[model samples]
Target: MRSLDFPALIYILLPEVFRIIELFHFHKQVNMYESQITLVMDTICPWTYLGKKRLDEALAQFRASPSSSSISFDLQFSSYQPSPSRPETIPDRAAHALHEKHNDNEEAQKLFEEHMISLAKPLNIPIAFTGPTGNSFPAHRIIQQVQESHGPEVTNKLVDALFRLYFAEGRHPGEDDMLIEACVEAGVGEKEAKDLVGDKTKGERKTKEDIRSIGMDIDSVPTVIIEGRRRDLTLTGLKEVSEYVKAMETIKKEST
Candidate 1:
């Protein structure tokens, strides 16, 4: 037999070695489990924003863990309106509405505000009830349209932008300007966003249907539903990051 040169031998074997490595990675990816996390929330709800931030933290923790290699996640947001009776554009500030809800008791309002601030402090979210309170239909419509067209990632970004605009910047959530700005921030073209915002009737029926569907099951915002392999896990209200991580671990264990 003729002697094989070392360099030529390596060159001949390198293609097969790379092919095997590629196959291994492809197989691993194919075998990973997929979990869907659906968040039912409104754009203007401060608690919902906190919930989203916490859930994101939990997901990051889980992704960094060893179990993440076996699983993938799909995050989605569903629309819900806490005050469906309010007009699309309201003149009263959110603080006034909150105070009115508590029968205009200044003490009660102060206590509630303090409670919100305390809860938000740990999460690093600036909870300001300074913006105008309205129907939230416009924001919901824009989010629904984005979700349909751009998928969950973009929709989540848009939701975050809207939250920041309202809670941190004290802007009206239902205003066209806010919606358009959020869309642009979420990577949608300004013209497309304008078109989406200009069409007043776009996503109205679907938003209403989603609101009705979600409302029938839960009367609260920030309800999270995780669709797992065996059964669905529902987490209501704001939860600790560890709690969410535990839920994901349970799902991952079941996946095995």
Candidate 2:
């Protein structure tokens, strides 16, 4: 009873301290610049690659402004498998496979190809999808390892390289040689990267589990998720850069 006052004051002050800490965190989130943008993408998605390039351009423009010139953003790359558990050979020959599937209606395939070509035109990249369309699970598993061990910057670089290899160059990204080349390009330890490719590590398992937990049945590539107040805002399929720009602005405003 004699120490009741002190105990009461301690309890009161603890909540106040927590409030201050919460306020500090809120402010920090609002002002975050260079490290704010997180790109959750899949290697197979063409539009994710295109959307990211466009988003990066917009961010560059933002950074160029006199007031925000010094501000940099944190670009974090996350994993998503558009076609999980699919056959490895399918991706290697995506164009042929898809074309054959749509053989009854040539326009069905041509229309899709036309969209891909248009997206690549602005970036001065060409895609023929001549090779394999293998399962991305193994490759995505490798990506998880890179992100865990190397860091976000390394992951981002590797992701960009993979995107270029698969979408622009139309190579089989699921191939070991191609993936190793991408890892090396990102400055990752080549031997370590290769070893971890199909290791069934915790991170890889978690990524795959998360994708399924969300119940996302992705039929196509380039699904972009914009983290919003309520949950994630998803952009499915190939979208114009302008749409991404608008989405970014909305996220910024929401943060405010």
Candidate 3:
């Protein structure tokens, strides 16, 4: 009877211990999520700011799930100039002008701002529409310099700074100091940022030329292009998380 009791105890205790260990491992995996996203943005677009915030929340939710079907990914940054040819003092004249032209006609700009605020509320992101419409050459050039040297991660940091400054703080994105500050905050050397902006006469034209080479239409600020096997996916305006996730899933499946 004693010998039988010992083996029974061993079986019961071992299974419980194994179950506990399994639960811990499952918890850890559920908390782990590795994925990447590419955000193509122009600070002039309030929707871009809102879209990014929502995308981040969605990605966070994805990471919190424990599905073996899910794989890790990265978020990459892409450049888009909404008003590539606007003067330096104003960065987003096209969208604003369209808004003003509509005066009493349900202004698209007002509609966009309202939508951005609503979308941003859930993610604790704030956006306003007081920035000037102007050239993005100075800012893009700094980003280009970062991309050329430190790579996309650096580009991402600068992009984030731009969003915060324009959307939340209502700062003019075209202001050289604002851009320089964002660069420095992102670990860009002050001298390099200055050099990029200081050489704006040559730099601005070259920046526009470089942006044009990407071959994207300059009609909108937040253009997201996801390349796939069947076709290239292009999204403009403010997008929801579900939309981005659906596109990402399609791209992932095609690649696999």
The digit string of per-residue lDDT tens for model 3 on 1-256 reads 4456887889879989999999988976675444445567666666677777766666666556543244555666556775566666745544555655455455665675577577778878776666465666666776766766777667778888987887777677768889888988888889987776677674456556767765356466466666554555667777788886677666556544
Q: Per-residue lDDT tens digits of candidate 2, residues 113-227?
A: 7887887788776666676667776567777778778887898788878888887677776887888888888888877767765355647668788667544655455556666
Candidate achieving higher lDDT, 1 or 3: 1
The Cα local distance difference test for each model comes to 0.87, 0.69, 0.67
TM-score of each: 0.92, 0.72, 0.69
lDDT of 3: 0.67
- Candidate 2, poorest ten consecutive residues by summed lDDT: 65-74
| Index of the highest-TM-score prediction | 1
Please identify model 1 stretches exceeding 4 Å from their true place.
1-13
Candidate 1 Cα lDDT to native: 0.87
